[model samples]
Structure formats: C-alpha cells, structure tokens
Target: MMTIVVSVLFARSTRSTFPSDGSTSSLITHYLAGAAIASGVIVTPPAVLALTTYVLAPSLRHLFERLLLYPLFGAAALVFLFLAVTTWKPGPGTPTSNMDTAASLVNAAAASALATSGIIVTTTGILASNFWLTLYFDARRCHPYDHIVLFLLGTAAHIRRERHRWHDDNQVTIWRASLEVVAVQVERDAPLSGRTGLAEGSAYMELRQEARRIAAVIRSHKRDLAEAYSAHDVDAVVASLVVGLRAFCVGDRTALLAHAPAEVAPRVGRFARTALRLIPATVLIVAGILLPLVPSIAHSELASNLRWYLIVMGTITFITTREDLATKIGEAVAKVLLK
Candidate 1:
C-alpha cells in the first residue's frame, strides 16, 4: 500500500523531466522500459540465489528451499495507475496566450507521454524496493541471501549517467536560459504585438513553452539533489545546491538568483540525514542477521508471530532507504569484482 502510494507520488513529481515529442511511440517506449525493469526486479532474487549458489558457496541453498513460503511478487498492477497520472511538457512553439485546437491536442499527448516515463521510473524503483525487502526478509526467515539486487537497481537509477540525461551542465544552462526568457516575458505584461495585433511568430509563445519545460527540469533537478542528500553525496549536494552568486553578466546572476527555490538549498547535514534514513533499515537488517544466533527466540511462538510483521517492516524500510549508502557499497564491490 505504502509502496504504491510512494510510487504514485514520485511519478507525479518527476514526470515533467522525461524527453517526449508528444507522440504515442515515445510513451510506449517508456512503458516498455518500465515493464522490463519491473520484470527483471521480480525474477532477480531467485536468479541471484541460483547464480551465487553455483559460483560461490552454497550458503544460499536454504533460501531457495523457503522461497515458496512467502508471497513476494505483485507490484506491476499499480504501474498503469501511476503512468496515467503523469503530466508531460508540450513542444517548443506551443502557444499559452491563446489555446489553439491543434496545440491543445499536442499538449495533451505530450503530457501523457511525459507521465508514462515518470510512471515507468516510479514503478521500476518500487519493484526494486520490493526485491530488496524480499531479499532481506527471506534471509531473516532463515532463507538468507546477499542483497546484490539493491545495489544493482540503485546504481541503475541513481548513479548511472546515461539513464538521466537531464543532469548535465549544458542542460542546466538551457533550463536557466528558458526560465530567464519566460521571466522577462511575464514582466513585460504586454502581448507580443507589432503594428497591428499579436506577431505571427511571437517570441513569447516559444518562451512560454520553453518555460514549462524548464519548470519540469527544475523539479527533476531538486529531486536529484534530494536523492544525493539521502545518499550522503555531499559534494554533489553542495555543487548543485550552492548556485554561484557570480554570473558572467548582471542578467545571468539575476536569473540564477531567481532559481534559489528550484535549486533547493541544503538544510540538514548530509551525514546526519543519511544516518537517520539508514537507522531503521540497519536495525531491521541487523536484527534479521543476529536473531537466529539466539536460539530461544529463533523458533519460539513469539518469533513465528512476529516473522510476518518483521518482513512487512523490512519491506517498508527497504522502500524508504531507496538510494542510501548501500548503493555506494554495491558500486564499490562491482568495481573491485570487475577489476
């Protein structure tokens, strides 16, 4: 329930950043990608167990034995709901002054496409979160296995560059320019009129659409910074948060200053924020690891009753700690192994 709710919230918040041409094909591509990620997440636990058992020690052999006991695979159904709520940005020359019939249709389709991609990302993350919980609890329930899946999904979603094209300096420049143009337009108050009425190729119209695109980009940037904060990426947070006071020109500095809220200033310390986020998951994972050592509670009736509860808690924490230190650890291990 919480997973679905969070998925919807995350999708809606970040849907505007997806690159779409307001076409059906673009939306379909995102949906397909989402499905692929979700499918991979679902099967990853068992696949990891099998591969690890064969290559490494057979310590996870018992996990495969108890796989059927817990019902841990049903998050794909809520994906469509998340996608349907997505809001996409329109084309470059979309007119905001007067709503044209063709422009409206284009905007609507673009919105749907944008929404689809956002929903796809959200659904994939949630499914991955579920996989993390399953791996953690399966071990706790005496089907112990390593959490390789968490690192894999986290690296794909948070660390990788190709997956998030908008997180670039060039893109940030475009966003700032678009926003400044729109700001100047709004300040003018008058329409883009000439000798007669409105101009045929009004610059305001293009700027308006560009502004919409920039708004989405800013929202996505803030989200990226927040995730970086959670993951204790202090350098990233500082670089992104502290928008330089000095710009090449006075206009440029004013425009940058206007984007303070969008830049999302750092409040809490990165280490403190990360520690807080990890505490619950750490306690859950640690308890799961150490519980079996104490034989009295390991097989007692109390343990049996709390087993389901603990699993539920573990799943919630897994979703909450989406891209914390665990992701960095996973990436480090991967680099070492690859070498």
Candidate 2:
C-alpha cells in the first residue's frame, strides 16, 4: 500500500514540477536535477524495506506498538518548540552547537525515514499474509479515490496560481518589502485598492512596479537593522522590532494584511531579529524532534508536541501570510489588548 502511494506521489510530483527547461537558467536546471536525484535516492531504501518486510512477516499478536519509549519522541519535540519560540539573541555554543545539532538532525531524519519504510512494508505484509496475496503483485486501498483527490487538489492549485499570478507576485514583493513600510504604517496601515481602472497588462505592470517601489525600503531597512545591532542600542532594537513587525502586517496575497490579533502574530523585529530569534528557535524546535530519537535522550512526548506546534504555526502562517497592513495592525492591536 505504501509502495503504491509513494510511487504515485513521485510520479505526480515529477510530472507536475519538472517542466521543460528550454529557457530556464542552468542553475535552475541543476537545482531541479539535484532535487530529482535526492528524491529518488531517498525513496530507494524504503521501497526495498516495504517489499521485503511485508513479504516475509505473516502474523503478529499486535499490529502496532505503543510503548512508553514512544512518548519520549513527544518530549524532544516540546523542548525544541520552546527553544524555537523563545530564541532571540545569539551567543556562544550557538554556532558549534548548531553545527552538531544539524548533523544529528540529518542522521535522525534518515533513520526515521528508514523506520517508516520498514513499517509500511510490515503492514502490507500482514495484510497480504492474512488475506492471501501473491509476491510480485500487491493490492492497495482506494487507489482511484486517492488519485481523484490528488487530481482535484492539483487542478485547484493550478487554477489559483494562474488566477493570482500578479496577485502572488504582489504578495511576494510585499513580504520582501515589509521593512520598508514599518515607519510609514506605524500610524496607519495602507489601504486596499479596488481594481484600478486599467487594462490587464497595464495593471500587472503596475503591480510589478509597486513591488519595485518597495525595494529601496527593503534595502534601507536592512541597513538600519545592521546599524542598530552594531550600536547595540535599545532604541534601535525597538525601532527594528517596530519595522520588522510591521512587515508581518503588510499584505495578504492581495495587498491586505492579517487583521485578526497581534497575539496571533507577534512580529519578529528584523532580519537581524529573525536570525537572532526565529532561526535558533527553528533549530531547537527541529532538534527537539531529531535529538530524542537517538541514543542520547530520545523522548516520544517531545515529538508529539513538536508535531502539534508545527501544525498550529503552519496553519497560522498560511492564513495570515497574505493579509494586508491594516488587517495586521488590527490583529496586532487585538494581540496587545488580549495579552
């Protein structure tokens, strides 16, 4: 079952992603090549495990194991989440520790993939052994329905990208330009414009132009962040925070910011803030998941918490990513009051 699903996904991903690179840069081509190679390389062992394990195993008293050791995974995840949530400044052991952490993460991830592959293989084996199935041929659940869901989802995504190409560009630019708008919008967030009474191409060109307009702001913010951090001034730090947070509230896909609540979106201060904060936190959060599985201090509880945190933050970021400035401010205000 897992074999079939993975194969289908690979095939679909390949078909959808690797378009002809007649006009693309060599860098893009190389990147895609690397990606394709990595995916195939990663899938090979799991494919082998699923084929062998399921074929050999016949019966077991229990299908799945839920031991105390599993919760260990959850604990690791929670610790990492806390680190990721709170990381703000840089310090010693931060660099070398980070290196060691990354390497361990890679090893753990590889092992995890191997374990999952083996499980899928075992599950299929049990099902086949109990139901009576051949070795070469395998049966799976709802191949058609799964494919249908994939198709529908893919089609919808395609339509959306096409419909909002300009809008998407606008969004990408707006996010990139968040630092630029900080000072301007501290008093009032930008207003959303209705469709400009212009031709389609003209509108898109103007959209791109607006994106260009924010470029200087982005650069200026970057410089300001550097200067503030170098000076180690609280005022600069606060100013940087103000500017960076302002970006999160800048725009949704259509030049609209998230207007829900500030607690909902505690904006990081700047790229410096992000580096000092988000990255370390992300590393810890990831480490929390990756570390506990190893021989040292693996905990299942941490892993479970990490998974939930990812889901929660993933949903929040996805929803607010495209909101405009006013909405973000409104939400930010909401956050301040709520807290």
Candidate 3:
C-alpha cells in the first residue's frame, strides 16, 4: 500500500515532464519489460534445479545426500550464472534501433531472460526444492497490480496531455523559462559563496533570504499572475514573478522586484473540494489509529479488521485524489505559510 501511494505520487509529479504523445507507450513498454523480468526471475530457480539434478543425478547422488549443503551449492551456482548473464552489457555501438529488428529482439529477449533469472535466484532461492511456490504466489498477490496501476497512470497522463496540449505546452514553457532563470542565478552566485554545501554558511542563508523575498513578491502579485494565466497574456514581469515562485518552491533564492494588482480572490475552492474527499480519509485514519486505545474494542477482531479496512480505504482515496488540484492547494498553503 505504501509502495502504491509512492508510485502514484511519483507518476503524478513527473507526468508533466514526459513528452505528451510518447509518454504512455514508453511507460507501458517499460512496465511490461519489468514484469517480464520478474516472471523470468520467478521461474529460473526451479528450472536450474531440475536441470542439474536430472543431468547429474547418478554422479551427484553422494552430494545430494547432504540436502541443505547441496541445495546451498546449487543456489550459489545459480547466483553466479545469473550475475554473469544479467551484467553482460553489449558494446556501445550495438544496434538497438528498429532498423536492426532481429538484433534488437534478440538483445531484448536475452536481457529480459537474464533479469528474470537473476531476480528469481536472488529472492526465491536457486534450489528448485525451496519455498519457490510460496514466494511466487506471494509475489503474484501485489506485483502485477502495482505495474497495472502504473500503466494506467501513464495512460491517464497521456490522455490528459493530449486533451490539454496547448495549456500544457504553455505551462511547460513557463516552467522551462523559470528553470533557466534559476540555473543562471545558481551558476552566477554559486562560485561567489565558494562553499558547495547545500546547508552551510553565508551562501545558503543568502539563498534562503532571497527565496523568502521571492515568495513575498509572488504573494503580492497573485492577482496579476492569475490574470496573466487566465488571459494568456503573461508579460515579462509576470513571468519573472512566476519564476520567483518556482524558484522558491525548489528552495532557491535570488532578489527580484515586480509590480502587480492589489486584491486577489481566495483560490481555496479547489482545496475545499479536495478537503471534502480527504476529510473522511483523515477521519478514518484517525479512527484506525485510536481503535487500539479504546478498551472495549482494542482486542476485538472486528476492530482490527475495521482498522485495516480504514487504512486501505484511506490509501485508495489518497491515490485517487486529483493530483493537479492538490498540488495547487499545497503551493497556495506553502505561499501563505511562508509569508
């Protein structure tokens, strides 16, 4: 459940960075590759054990008498083999493009096989007689579902990108420009500080101060920023202010001055919507945590199951929440608190 939550968070955070059209297919292919590799690893130990035992049965009868020692040796051999195959990278100029179809396919297949074998040997043990079946079943319970969720997340991102191509492009441009400004400032100021530490000395303090100033500037210019975004007329001043906000978000600092409108309306409506969903989940989590503290329900099976159910439901709610709106709310809160 934690893994799923983290993955969903990561997918949403980075989705905007992926190329609009190709992101989904690229992500799906990667997940498929991972699944294939996992499957291969799951099956390799049994295959190795069967091969070695059957092929050398008569000769290895004496060794097989010491069951634990023999299996350990077999496992060691599988480990060595798995390592060799998986780490055998081809030459730099290897033809991996579509034009070299056969070579690509063969290379991909070999890599997948080696990865799968390596994983199986590493996790489930190389000996066929180990708890291979138990491990495989356990893996099946959660692994595939995680990959499927990742795939679906990628697909959703792709659909969103396509649907809002122009808007996304504009946002991307804004952020890119913001990043460029930040990079320039870092490059210019980093050397003056002389120290390279992220959390030390005058440079770091200066950066923090600058960040606070930038955050203040952004807060003051909220109305203008909103107008620019809505009207699609982002001027240099607004762009700079947005960059300042972005820089502040990423813990960067540089001083800049800007002017803008006076009064900004509350943008908490989105946060309210998100809170409507999150409130129940938060309550559920609180209830779950407090269940054990209650004398009457502490030892009850129903209480334990209810706690688990609430946690699961809360996690699901978190994953399904609208990431964009949540991110905006978070940014708004950050700005307010920083002020």
* lDDT of residue 306 for candidate 1: 49
Question: Which lDDT value does model 1 have at 218?
Answer: 32
Of candidates 3 and 2, the better by lDDT:
3
**Alpha-carbon lDDT, every model:** 0.42, 0.37, 0.44
Give candidates' CA RMSD values in order. Answer: 29.0, 28.3, 25.1
lDDT of candidate 1 over 1-339, digit per residue (tens): 456555655554443333334455654555565456545544566455455443342222334434421222232333344345544345567666433433444433444433443454555556667777985777565311012222223322333332244445554443333333323222222222322244555665543343333333334454454344233352453344233212211224245335433332322433355457668766866675567457887876556434444444554565556556555654554454433
Q: Candidate 2, residues 293-323: lDDT per residue as tens digits? A: 6653445444445444444343444334344
lDDT of 2 at 80: 28
Q: Give candidate 3 misplaced runs (Cα > 4 Å).
A: 1-112, 116-207, 215-339
Which prediction has the highest lDDT against the true structure?
3
The better candidate by lDDT, 1 or 3, is 3
Residues 1-339 of candidate 3: C-alpha lDDT, one tens digit per residue? 234333433433332233333445554454467447645554466456545653433222223334433454455346435434343333667655532433333344444444444444443343443555644675566432232223223322432333333345555444333333333333333333334466566766654444334334444433333344332343443345444444334434333423322332323333355567778778868876787569888776566666665565565556567667655654554454433
Deviation from native of the Cα of residue 136 in model 1, angstroms? 17
Looking at candidate 2, the ten consecutive residues that score lowest on lDDT are: 58-67
Residue 251 lDDT, candidate 2, scale 0-100: 32
C-alpha TM-scores of all predictions: 0.20, 0.20, 0.25
Question: In terms of lDDT, which candidate is stronger, 1 or 2?
Answer: 1
